[model samples]
Target chain A: MLELHQISKHYQPGGQLIEALKPISLTIKAGEYLAITGTSGSGKSTLMNILGLLDLPSRGDYLLDGVAISSMNDQQLSQIRSEKIGFVFQSFHLLNHKTALENVMLPQTFGTVPLSDIRQRATHLLQQVGLAERIQHKPAELSGGQRQRVAIARALMNQPKVLLADEPTGNLDSQTTLEVMALLEALNQQGQTLILVTHEPEIARRARRCLVLRDGEVVSDHLQRCTDPTQF
Target chain B: MTAQAKFYYLHNHLRSCLNELRSHALRSMLTTLGIVIAVAGVISIVAITEGMNHSLVKNFSQLGTETMMVRQNIFKAMNNDVLQPMTEREWFALQNLQTGISAVAAFSRVELPGTGVSGVRISYAGRSQIGRLLATSANLPQMTGRYPIDGRYFADSDSDARRRVCLVSEELAATLNLQLGANKPLLQIGNFQLQVIGIMPGGNRDILGTSADVYLPLGFAMQLNPKDIALEFGFRSLDESNTEHIKRQVNQLLRQIQGTRPNETANFVIENATELKQFQTDTLGTIRTVLLLVIAISLIVGCIGIMNVMLASVSERTREIGLLRAIGASQSYIQSLVLTEAAILTTVGALAGILLGLGIATIIAAGIPQIEQVILPPAAVVLTVCCAILVGIACGALPARKAALLSPITALNLE
Candidate 1:
């Protein structure tokens, strides 16, 4: 489980104070499929960044699995991120120079795993994501959906309990988006907690819970069936 | 982390660094140019310096290590201070001492009395060229191993009688068609004429030099101008091991003959060929030190150049660095990645520079060669490359630190 107690982000450009995220408290239980939907500049990206531990909150506290994140140093934060959190960006942020298998093996490079095991596990993850035949393709060589699939495989390389995806299907065509969403849903069904950041209502309708944010504040937090949110 | 995990991490970092270079080959080459030039400079300078040392040692070998050059006012040669000259009687007394020395020659440099021309003119069958005049004793060949190889040396009788006869080395003989035991054998030195009784067989190569030489007796040299002939003595011992003893004996005899008080510093200097060789070696060593300092400075500049490029590379890869941070790469990992890239660039440059420098050195050595051929010492090449690697690490440090210090969010937002 992940928990936030009134976590908010503030920054200043030159001398003007800007509140990017307002004080809000929230929590998500284990194995929950959560969608955070917001328009442009609705602080959804900022919230995802804080959830992934990419940035520290200007105020408030964050705890994951009952361990306080506010007091950890950068290196300790990195260890926790590697061991407990997985991040998937909208651009599919796979290193352009590496092949699919190499990208999948990257997270383990920073871990305490032996090389031989990392290789085997990377190969198995690619297979689990239906990319066994495309393991050698670089990002440029793969289709949009295939690249997103590789990113998903790489994210699952360390087997993190919490997966944070910021618009995983944002760059794909509609048909490929369905395939990527299906893969994500399958991983969620297997009990990995999934947190998706998107602005599309149709995509948010598939989540077990939806949180709509506006003007740096959470406007709505409600549970929904797999297909009920389009009727909102 | 465990050692195995560290190795695994290093392996991946090395692979990615190499991949980064492969993707941007031209930029890598440009960044490494300074290292290439630096390594090449060091290697070639060392090669030539080593080559010159070999030739000087060879020359010293031919000089015969036991040989000594005795000169007055040698220590104060830079000044015009007057010294007590060795009289003819004193030279004979030192030569008769039955000391460690086997052969010795006292030479006097003189010009023709009326004409100021330093060399004498010889005309045989209308072939006229200026030849050097050396006033020497009969043991000319034994003193320095430069003797007449073709004809004959000066006999003691010729020096005793103060004969107006002279011997010409073959190097001078070829110019005038001079011969031994000819019906007509005479050359003109100014208005005074002398008969050429013998031809001296000459060595093609001499330690100092082999030139057109006309040998005259000491009596004949005194006949030119006894007052102005600057005198210098040279001697060689049968046993090189007893040179110090011979030098002491010569000094004592000279002091007794010149009548200097016991406590006064002797004005003459005795320099042996081995000592000269050591001096040459020391001089060359000094030159090598100075050159190495200059090369080290240039290499430092090369290091700074690499640092500048590393800074540029780190700033350019901001987004990638952030991604690595987000993916849980530690600060040390990012730092190592940057350093690894710099090290790879410098290694490639240094290797290429070694080849280029050695190739150029080989061409130079081939063009100008000594009796003993020379090549670069392998240890120097190895050390230079190791120095390059060290410089490369220093060059990458600042940039790697800068990259490691960037906040993951700030870096990810950098365009």
Candidate 2:
């Protein structure tokens, strides 16, 4: 479970204080698939960064599995992020020089996993992302969809508690986007908690819960049933 | 992680460092050039220094280790108000000393009557050459460990009888086209004709050097120049083990004869073969230190080059740093990774430098026949490698710190 009690974020650029995210309360139970939808300057990216533990909230407390994230030191925060959060970025962010399997094993390189088990788990995750045969292929050699799958495999390498996808298909073709979305849906159906941030309403509608934001304020928070039965 | 696991990760860090270099081969090679030159210079200098030391020891062994030279301390006499010259009186005092010496001889550089040039002119068989004239006693053969390769050395009878017999070096004999033994020719030395009795060994490689081309009986030469008072004394100890005792006894006798008071320093100096070798070794050590200083400067320049390249690498790989951080890498891990890259760069350079240095040393040794062997001192090699690695680590600190302190979000957002 994740809880954000009136969490807000602001930044100062050349003396002007701009609020990137307003104080907004939110909660999501385990295995919940939530999508945050917003247009440009809508603070969705800021909220996703805060949720991923990449940025700290300026006001309010964030609790993940009953541990206060705001009071933790940088090292402790990194440990929590490594163990509890996995991120799929718009750019994939896979090391281009590394093979798909190496990219997947990157997360565990800094963890306590034994060397032999690291390779085994990375291979299994890569296979689950439908990249079994392409494990040795580098990022440049793989298609956009394959690279994103490698990123997803890497994010799941440590068996993180929550998966955060921020416009994960932004650089992919529509066909590849559908494939990635279906993979996400499948993972969600398997009781994996997923958080997706996208401006596309169609993409947002596929999630079990939708939260829309405008001008740094949350405009709507509701649960929805997907129209596509295949993605259920 | 456990200690063993951390060690394994260090291996991974080195592997990644090497991989990074492999990807940017040209840049890495350029960055390491300074280190290569510095290590090569260091190695070659040490090799040559070792070779010279080996040669010095060999030359000392070839000469008599028991031989000791007694002469006026020129630097000390210069500072004193009255310059005390070592004359025959001091020589007589040394001869009467109770130390166990094998032979005692007095020598001086004699100037011919009309030849004022430093060396005396000698003509034999119509070939004329300038020869250095040495006036030494019959004990010269025992003191120098050098005997005539072709005739007999002067005898005490020759000195007692005041005969004008002289010895010519084998080098001068060959140049003058003179035959030795029964039909030996006489050398002309400034209005006096002396019979050449012996031909000593030639070649300047001797410890005392083959600078003296001609030698005459000391008493006979002194009688010819009775006014020349600055004479040097030399003696051979009974054995190599007795040389130090003989030196001390001789020093005490000379100080007493010269009337040097109890608190005053000795005006004369007594030198044995060991002290001479140590002086040469110390001079070589000074040269080695100077050479190492130059190489150290080059190493510092190399370090700066490595630092510059690492900074560029950090800047170029900002996003990579963020990605690693996001995955789970600690800041210390990132710092160590960058440092490993620099270390690998310098290590490669040092290895290449060692090969090049040995090659250069071998070439130099081959060119110079005096150098007995090309020596690769293990300590110097180890020191060079250590120096290079330390330079890498020193230069990597700033750039590594810069990379480690970068915000992961800001770094990941860089396009």
Deviation from native of the Cα of residue B397 in model 1, angstroms: 1.5
- lDDT by residue (B242-303, candidate 1, tens digit) is 88888888888888777878986676778788786787678779987998788788888888
Regions of candidate 1 where Cα sits further than 4 Å from its true position: A225-232, B54-275, B351-356, B368-383
DockQ of each: 0.35, 0.25
Q: How many angstroms is residue B408 displaced in model 2 relative to the true structure, after the best TM-score fit?
A: 1.4
Off by over 4 Å in 2: A225-232, B1-4, B61-279
Model 2 C-alpha lDDT per residue in residues B39-64, reported as the tens digit of each score: 88888888988987887887788666
**What TM-score, over all chains together, does every model reach?**
0.69, 0.69
Docking class of 2: acceptable
lDDT values, one for every candidate: 0.79, 0.82
